[model samples]
Target: MIIYDLACTAGHRFEACLGSMFDPNPDCGCGASTSRVPSRLNLGGAANAGPGRDDMPTTWHGTGQGDPATLKAWHGAMTKRERLEERYPELAGDRRPILAHEGAFAGRPLRAGDDLVPTVAKAAFGKEES
Candidate 1:
């Protein structure tokens, strides 16, 4: 079997296995079950050059890097939450309410302030004055 990095139209990327070089049904791991395309392979440069090349590819190198946007979003969310807690001690003191409310909002799609970033923003600025 061969593993390949597959990316869907929705930008969901994942690994897939093919029984052989001719096996079909390769697709992305998205919940929609879309067909996958071979983005890259691990032939160790043998597929590109003849034997005894001075610049042979190394096998120990890492493969299948992740999407930068997804990683940036995750880091931004964590940083926003941390900043919120530091700025508002009262809100940090009571996290259960914030988490519960944010969780409920996150269940809905195409909504704002549903994730940790917006949740922290609301906690820091959306509260009504007593």
Candidate 2:
């Protein structure tokens, strides 16, 4: 059997046990039984090209536009934020204060009611002054 770090659409992360390489229905451990496996990556066999294959986009490393790791981290953070908002509706509007106080967006000018753009752009582009 193999253990995999599984995440649900609700952004809940948990461990899953697979009996074989082809486990049809992996449980999310979040009480929601679904076939959607968010964290499984095919990394073996003839159909798979192993790790770090050329088929993956090379622009991140070669062109210095953006890194895939950073993008994935940002995506994870966003997912968690969405989950938190869903869990606590009262805290949904409280995110603005956190974003404003975050060091990444400190000193960045906000456009009237739009405060998330600076934080998002800084996180995405790695620009401290964005």
Quote each prediction's TM-score: 0.24, 0.24
Which stretches in model 1 have alpha-carbon errors above 4 Å? Answer: 33-130
The 10 consecutive residues of candidate 1 with the worst lDDT sum are 48-57
lDDT of 2 by residue, 17-121 (tens): 779768865656666654444566677746421222222345656534686676676556656656765776754542333324346446663334564655567
Largest lDDT belongs to which candidate?
Answer: 2
What C-alpha RMSD separates each model from the true structure? 22.7, 18.7
Evaluated with TM-score, which candidate comes out highest?
1
Model 1 C-alpha lDDT per residue in residues 1-130, reported as the tens digit of each score:
8876667677777777778867765455555455566676666755321122122223334211445665565456556656765775654433333334344345532233346666555555664334
RMSD of 1: 22.7
Residue 73 displacement (Å), model 1:
50
lDDT of model number 1: 0.52
